[model samples]
Target chain A: MAFQLVLPDSKSVSQAPSPLAYAVDRTFFYAAAAGALAIILLVIYILWEIGGQALPAIGRSGASVLVNTQWDVQNSSFGILPQIWGTLYSSLMALLIGGFIGVSIAIFLTQDFLPHSLATVFRTLIEMLAAIPSVVFGLWGIFVVIPFVRPAADWLHDAAGFIPFFSTSLSGPGMLPAVIVLSIMILPTVAAISQDAIGLVPYKIKEAAYGLGATRWEAILKVILPTASGGISSALVLGFGRALGETMALAMLIGNANQISLSLFSPATTLAALLASNFPEAGAIERQALMYAALVLLAITLVVNVAGTLILLWTSRKMAKA
Target chain B: MTNASVLEKPTATAGAAIDCNIDKIYYGKFLAVRDSNIAIEKGKITGFIGPSGCGKSTVLRSLNRMNDLIKGFKLEGNVHFHGQEIYDKGVDPVVVRRHIGMVFQQPNPFSMSIFDNVAFGLKLNRFKGDVEERVQHALTRAALWDEVKDKLKASGLSLSGGQQQRLCIARAVATQPSVLLMDEPCSALDPIATRRVEELMLELKNDYTIALVTHNMQQARRVADITAFFSVDISQGGRTGHLVEVGPTDQIFDAPQEKLTKQYIGGEFS
Candidate 1:
């Protein structure tokens, strides 16, 4: 026998849910999204207000503020060229010294020359160094590095005083200490990241090298290092960025001088050190000028970060194709 | 078992060839390969076939001292390559490996161009004369030149699986080693690629001694002039691999002396 079937109404099926419930769900989602948008907009607005107030000071002060030698805030005069030079010069010196030591340590740790247990111990020590705060490093630098470096600075002043770089008076805390402190500060960052990069090189490739009769050093130089070049570059950039923006440590050792000197032992100031030293007591105009310094710092960091991102993207693309 | 005991001693006929008598142990305790013996002809294809954990690969690796990479691995017997003990204290593994190249189970081409990968070994050994010509010659010998000649600058990874394996083979052979060890070189390839590799191997044996470790018995039967079969015994607390038989491929398949060999060859034990 054939059975008859019944069909439900399409209108009731379509209208099963209450519109209020839908409205409540939609409202919650929109509210959460709007809250996130508000936070972002608030941050952007604050930055814009600060940046707008600071940029005009540079224009009012003119190219002298950017390229002049003196930074006398008392006479309504301000120049950051010396400070900029100090910052770049010290950071570059730090990078060169720190980068060499850090990459060497990384290679030693990752290579087969050392015993496994010793390598582990060395790696652990480096990681611990990274955990020490910048303030602690500053204190250590003042107490320990100053005495040892004072003699060297004096020697440079006496022996090589004919050279502009070595013409400093060699009294106390200065570019030499600042550069040394910055180097020690950035050491852990470079070493740890470089070791991590070297470790990321696949074992299979090294084995392939060995299978082809490559010596331990040959395998590392030809196969492992090239494969890890991108990561190592990123590590170096990270160290550079850290050195560029370091504040408390540099301030403690940089002597707070705005005069640029060619000598490693001479007194000089960096932007962060300058900001830290005088930001609390600065008047409205002085504060705006300091903010302009901050703005310059921000621009420099932004450029560095953008460059790092581009490098990372290009390397990843190359790796993917490889 | 009686025949295995007799085969433990080197054949008097192989007076001038390389003999690898590998007794592998793991952790300084567990015996992996027990009294295994094989004589490698100077320029011929010899295939080793066994089930998983049969220690065929261990014996293959012992020839070039590849087993030295493993921690706590020890060997009791000697592997003599051209009458010189490979395990001697002064014998450098690097120099040994330079004269004896290897291809792995997987196609592990470097992340460089096809030309560069082939040129890697030569450069590592500091081959100073006409590198381009040597690289081209190696590529042609490995049967990869025609396919990759136009794209030598392309990354080795960009090639198909077969092409990559051939590229690896080219890289290995470019060093002009006397012996070429292949650890299941065609296992990761398709049937067509496998056939191409097999043909290449046959062609290569004329110039270099070839030792192959494979699980595919048919591949062993097709390409190997001599075949060695290994089996595992677990009663010894650790897996003990022993060479059950070694002979010409036809004799081993048609008239195996032992019942176990017959069972394995007739496909009775799945």
Candidate 2:
């Protein structure tokens, strides 16, 4: 009976459908559907749980929680404007640096600039960078990146002290070091996705470009890059999201100062860094505030991912129309 | 004077547009095709027809160094265009392709406007002429101007399959290349579209040397002034494709010298 319903046009069956087979099929379908529905519910549950814990702070501060930049513990006034700014600023800077390098690496690997075997080797090595633990990246930044960026930061401070970006001296871990480490940390995500995007461009389209006598750079710059721009842009957006939420490396390297400074050498804090460092030993009000900040980070990441997805869809439609 | 010139049919010049003396074509260690000697005569249409895996497209791509884009693609041969070796150490493949343009099997118009697609080559070659006039001339020659002249700003991908193919042809001709290599240009279109493209080829032969790879025997007989036959040999533990015979289209269709060519044209393998 179930066979008739399921395979209405398949008349080659010699025997009637077994009830056991029908039961198995129904059970498998329900199991898979349950798995899918579970994830959706879990996501909503996480948002609800975080929002519920953050309600006290949200009710106390309201929209001012985002705009105010005070965090005095003795008098009990808490505002996370600097952390919000740091998160956005650092992530954008990282995206600019990492996004350029990542897309260039992707193009170099995918556009026949390297041998096939060498490309595979380099791709594997780049992806392996993602597997390293966040704490290890933090340790590496403290030991390696901090040293490398300090002298340059000091040089810029000395040579071009009039510029706001280089006005502060690099006495310790600062925004420049954190930004450099964060950029390196996000390189794998950007490069891998961009490589996939560039590689996915149909071979036929590339052949058409070359068939017209376009040199390598011409074909790449005029045709391949434009065709893959949507994917690359989305990749950068996702990288920005990753950089925004990065906690350990930024916390270790950003010096955790709670002020906004124009100088790249000034200490700063991010939302993720603030949450990770403060949540361990917080009083009643501060804990709620920390949870509220976590919610903001989640909201920012959610917005970025949604925007990235929309950009992907829009560009694909435009590409299809063309 | 115009009436008398129009009455006279265009004839093939004695000069060879692209001459090839190929020993072997290989992808890494595997021999793909071998032992081909052919010359595309100026002001005529030459067709390369054979069964699948016969390396007709391989030889066509080798003429313009398009195969150089493929990894492990190595050719032990010399392809000369207008008496200059294309595969020499100093000859840039880019310059070779600029002079010897190609149309692929698929109508691969770029993701750009119709006018941009036709002008892509002209811009690459740095043509200092009036771009709009040149684009119009190419479209007119490709027989696509009547259909697409008004919508020149429309995306090339928006057109029908046949129109897109003609757009590719127009793009190829807009560069004013001395030779055009077409690899099965009509296999993707309907009979009517194929007829239109074939007519465009006949009209184009007056100005450009054309080499075509076709699967359809009747299409070759209809449009090609000369046809080259290729067949694959499996006796060597691998399918090695080679040219069998090349002659006038009438001789190839009516009386082929080689048994493989005769069998292929006679529908023995189909």
Candidate 3:
């Protein structure tokens, strides 16, 4: 026989699965659904526990807890406005520095600028930064980062005294060191994810760019960056989350001062740092206030996550339309 | 082999747009193709027709130095574009590509708006003229202006497959390159789309020299003025591809001198 084109019977094929396979398939589907439901339930349960514990503080102080800046343990007046400002300010600063460095590193590694072996080595080293424990990072920040940064902070304060960011003289652990440490802490997270995003851009798209007489830099800046923007932004958001939740480094480096000031050299405290520093030595009412502060931090993080997701959706839609 | 009897000698004719004289093309010491000579004449469509694994695409890619992107792809030969040695040490490939644009086997438009896709080359070259006018001119030349005129702001990928391929053609033509290389431009398209692209090629011959690598013999006969045939050789225990013949399309299809060409056209083997 020369050849024959045999057509499968669609009716038989659709119904031909073994009974065991059907049972296994259904079982897997139900198992995955249950796992997803469990995750959602766990989140709700945690929120419930935190909210219930924070209720005592919320009832005792009302809205005064948010706007109050003085935290006198003896008088039991707990105001976390300064800590909230420090938390937002520090995380945003970390995001700006870390996001730029991470995206640059990702582009450098994935765009064939480095030799393959060298890129691999650099990538591995960057990833290993994440494996170092947070406490170790804190210790490193206290010794190496603070010492190295003190002179620069002092010079900035002297030279640019009129600017509020550099008005205060550097005495010891302060916002500058804390921001620097937080930035380094989140760099690996941002860089690794960004590398994956940039790497996933199709080779064909890059070729199209080069075919149009684009230099390597031109191709990367124009074609590859825009194509990977969505993924890169997601990576930044995750890095932001990592920076916001970091406690050990911030508690060790930030001066933990109760007063609010714009100077980077001035001591400051974040919500995570406040919780970590005050919970152990707190009396009963102070514990409730710390719990309430934790709840505020949780709300802020949730809002950031939601905003990131919305930004991603809006960008994709804009890209499609444009 | 006896087939060398019909092979054309390397000639640098005045009308040639791109001239290639090759001793060997190797991917990391493994000989992929050898002993090839082909010239793409100016203002005419030259087609490279060959079976799979015959290195037609490899030779086509070498003309524009697009093979430089591939790791270990080495061409031990000379490829001249309009009397300039494109592979010379000091000559930048980016500058060479500016004058010779290409359309890939797949429709590879950038994930950008249609207008931006066409304007990409113009922007890179820093064209001082109106970009909007140039984009419209290219789309009109590719026969895609009417359908996409109102939606130039839409993403290039939002179009149908045939439209996307045409959009890519417009993108390549927007920079006004002298030579256009199309590697299997119609292989991914339907017959109707293929016919439209063929018509576009016929219209583009007035201004640009085109080099095409195609698997379809009918397509070669339809649009190509001259055709180069490449075939694989396994007699030496390695399947190294080499050029077999280069002549007018009618002669290649109807009065081929080589027995291999006759056999291939007679449907003896793919």
Candidate 4:
């Protein structure tokens, strides 16, 4: 037998593709590059707008915009203190009211405490309510909330008129109506997000809790709620963001006065409401002032979103470690 | 040994064994498991052997009312634990499960430290003794104390696969449940891990009544005192599972009553 060198077939060698074929997959590379570039440009544009106008207004106004009680935009005197205070106060009120009701509704939905059909109907109603326009809510606030709150305002004014905060002028549509409208607006967001978060808790963990002789309430309190805490926090942050940025509803309901008052029944203006009421009438410096207000609102939203992201990341990391 | 004696006290003789009769139906029509019955003697390990979708897991889940979690699952039968009807309206399933602990197929240690995982049941049940001591004792019983004692505070997920399975077993037994239900506890483990779990099961039988579901016939022979064989009847178009035969492990292996049992033990169709 003649010893002959055996060689591998060239057919298999020819079948293997070059590295460029793997590296330059067209569809994926194009989509990824486009997404990255779009995000970069969006961030850059936002920074430029804020830097060009908002910073200058803030620097010029200094502590007066934050501390002074007056805002006379026509006469070139713009102070945001009252608007800032009103925004904080109303948002806090809305959070307190919405948080309680939303979490309760979420618990009810997840715990099978309601009939399945009823739960479904209620969930649908909430979703529809969420999708309803803010302008419609504002109209409802004007027509219904004002009349309903007038009696309560009268009672507070009669009972505690000596107190500065309760010296209610029995105003038409003001802080109280605005707060109520905001609470209703934020409710569906909080409830829907919280229900989803609670739903994401694994069945096994809940089953383990039940298997350990825990009561239904005990299992929810200890296992379900703790596991879903990060998600719930995100939900609350989302609701707060909505409350902060709400403009049309607040403008329609909040009497549109640029004065800070401790009374719930008094007329007050949030930053959003102020911008909505004055942005159309603003001139050179006034436009810059409105932009500054927008910047502040944007900063607040960014902080909330960043905090929510951090909380979610920390929770997932904790879960991974566990 | 004292703990073993406590578990063996009621069912010292074969006449006093707990009998489980489970009939399960899904949605008013589909039968998941039909007229399944088993006698679990105290302090003995009983294994259910079957193919996929063979109702072994359904029967196991029914022992502790874990089937109640399923939306349309309904059961009509008696599971007598110390002569009490488990399915009675007044009897709480949570309370029943407390006394009849369970270990799932996956090593589902909670998202907590090893110490906390072992302590979970004790705290839930308000077990009012020294928590540390109980956790240690349970860990020791599950044969995981030696490897994990120094790292009790570490995350339970930090353990190896075998160790996590053992940790779950330890957590289940921590509540001092008289009966333990394990649903293919070693199916996810490797060969070495499987052997370790088998050894642990044997040791556990001295102090707990164990009902195990396994697809591995050899594992059934190795660990079970009694073996119940189940098969899905696919002739009806949709699958419905039923128990084919059940008896002492030795009898099932040596002289099976049914041809299917014989074929199964002979490794013909497993």
The true-versus-predicted C-alpha distance at residue B114 of model 3, in Å, is 1.5
Q: Model 3, stretches more than 4 Å misplaced?
A: A1-33, A307-322, B1-13
Docking class of 4: acceptable
TM-score of 4: 0.86
Count: clashes, candidate 4: 0
| lDDT (Cα, tens digit) per residue for candidate 1, span A1-322 | 2233446654443333467777888999999999999999996887798788897687788566788777678886877888889888998899999988998899999886688999999889887887888888888878888888888778878888999878876667888888888997888888998888788776767778999988888888889888888877877888888888999988998888778778887778998998999889999888888888888877776677667667667766766554
Per-residue lDDT of B203-260 in model 4, one digit per residue for the tens? Answer: 9888899999998888999999989999888888878888999999999999999998
Which model is ahead, 2 or 4, in terms of DockQ?
Answer: 2
**Which pairs, if any, clash in model 1?**
A165-A262, A165-A263
DockQ of each: 0.54, 0.62, 0.44, 0.44
Ordered by DockQ, highest first, the candidates read 2, 1, 4, 3
* Sliding window of 10 residues with minimal summed lDDT for model 1 chain B: B1-10
Q: How accurate is candidate 3 locally (lDDT)?
A: 0.88
TM-score of each: 0.86, 0.93, 0.91, 0.86
Candidate 2 error regions (>4 Å)? A1-18, A313-322, B1-14
Which tens-of-lDDT digit does each residue in A1-322 have in candidate 4? 3234456764433343455675567768998999999999998898788767877788888657767777776677777888888888888889889877888889999888887899989998987888889999999999999999888789988998888867777679788899999999999999998898788777777777776667789888877887788888888888888898899999999998877788888999999998888878788898888787777777787787788677767766765554
* lDDT-best of 2 and 3: 2
Query: How far does residue A197 in candidate 1 sit from its true spot (Å)?
Result: 1.6
Q: Which docking band does candidate 1 fall into? A: medium
* Residue A136 C-alpha lDDT in model 3: 91
Better of 3 and 4 by TM-score: 3
Candidate 2 chain B weakest lDDT stretch, 10 residues: B1-10
- Which runs in model 4 stand beyond 4 Å of their true positions? A1-36, A74-77, A111-121, A152-170, A259-263, A313-322, B1-17, B23-27, B146-154
TM-score of chain B of each: 0.92, 0.94, 0.94, 0.92
After superposition, candidate 1 runs with Cα above 4 Å error: A1-46, A58-64, A114-118, A156-169, A313-322, B1-17, B27-29, B268-270
